[model samples]
Target: MIHLKKIKIVETSEGYGEEVLKKGFEFECGHVNLMVGDQGCGKSTLLRMISNNSKHLEITLADHVITKGIQSYYFDTEKDNPRVKDPQMYTSLSGKDEGIGYVGALTSRFRSHGEIMENMILDPLKDAKDCVVILDEPESGLSIKNQFRLIKEISAAVERGCQFFIATHCYPLIEAYDVMSLEHWKTMKGEDFIKLAREKRYDGTEKDNSD
Candidate 1:
């Protein structure tokens, strides 16, 4: 029901300018969007920008976030120490329009992937309002059944007023969360390198294979 309303990007040197990306280069979106990539693109960067802003505005390229991640994360640990604040996540225009549920980490709950996706992840949020949920490479840890369950969860979330912005290099995830694939995100983190992203998320004429 509610949208981000205004999405303005700030200027950065040697990259797409804010005006051009919003008005021209980038096909802008809101709470629910999907991003795909080949190897190295700016997908993660965009997600970080979106998620970092806690004003009912969310952008996520990864599976999860740690709140003000730039200053809060020090090698996967907290610095400023911001935990999952549910109301804050749902205080935006988007949240009021949708009945959203905000939970903390999905990493600490289950022992198996299936249990994690169904019971821990999807089951809990099935009734929550979710105009969007930004997820990073969810396929990295899930099984095929788990992935399918994830798809079910996403579909349910969308039907309930939630959208998603997911970042992934996995084929199954791409197919599962196939509503959109803006592009890939490229960045090196802790000796690892990510490749190009698809929409500025992956852009292609191919339709997603999932229902």
Candidate 2:
């Protein structure tokens, strides 16, 4: 089981220079910890820092080494500047690159993305010690069938004692994975946010418009 014991970011120069609070949240062993928040509540920010990369945030881990050991993966839906990047605070944190051992999953909207994640990554890494995965909206472009497959893959990985750090707005994830809703996870929860994610799962788009 891999759990986060601490994450304290004081003054990270890697991200936009702003006074960031020293923050840390703990998780249970080998569980898929989902973060649901509004578009700008820093859910992604918190995930990245947990993944060992947060710009301008000072991060200090209670356990640099875990019982399973220390490795991580990331699948960023928005894998570009301003959205995802190596936290500049790297230099100040430990004087060593925290992202060094992490495996960053490919960011693409291709139909085979789910397959790639299952076959190419999770299958191989699940047995390895210290492996963590960060899935950011893994279902963005997948069809309903494919989305189900992704869920299966994630569930399987979690069963094998692999820790997961995920950021997503997908409703299926919220329900299927039983991920906590944004209202529950984030301080800001609205009817619209919940409705949108729910609709995505049932595909309430056309119905909503017609009504």
Candidate 3:
């Protein structure tokens, strides 16, 4: 299991001279840690701070610092950039020397946004363990069926011991994981966040649509 015991940020020259976006925020790592909040509510800010400010934060796995290279996989769904070159490589590397027909078929199959994510993102990390996956609103371009598929894929990865930090507003996606709602985080009140983090299980019935 992984643990994030605290996060602290300071701005010396900003309006308030200094501010703490997060302090003593704690969560036990699980298969999924869904972060839900309204726009500009510091959800993405927290993830970025964790991913980039490793030097200043105290995050650990099994009593040791998490120092593995590429231990975190971030999928910024807002960008939606497709890798047009990878399909050619995938076909050629697949060793199916059946020529252009195979390549064409493979290319056509991954045209949808969800299929591209499955082939390019999820498939590669499906079996990953003891790592963190940070996704920002992955439901952006996915259909309901594809969203369900994404949930299953994430769950499978979680079963393999992967930890997820997802920032999303999709109701169905929110319903599918243990969520920490940031609706009140901007107020710097840690009670609600702590409660959700400690629960660490969605149970599929709790609902919070304010995000």
| Candidate 3 lDDT over residue span 133-200, tens digit each | 77777776677877787788877777775667788776666665556656544322234545544454
Please report the candidate that would top TM-score against the real structure.
Answer: 3
Clashing pairs in 3: none
Candidate 2, residues 66-106: lDDT per residue as tens digits? 33346566556545211144533121111233331123322
Error of 1 at 27 (Å): 1.5
Report lDDT per candidate: 0.41, 0.50, 0.56
Indicate which candidate wins on lDDT.
3
Q: Candidate 3 versus the native: TM-score? A: 0.60
Clashes of each: 43, 10, 0
Residue 192 in model 2: lDDT: 46
Model 3 lDDT on a 0 to 1 scale: 0.56
Clashes of 2: 10
Model 1, 142-173: lDDT tens per residue? 67777777677767666775656566665555
Per-candidate TM-scores read: 0.48, 0.54, 0.60
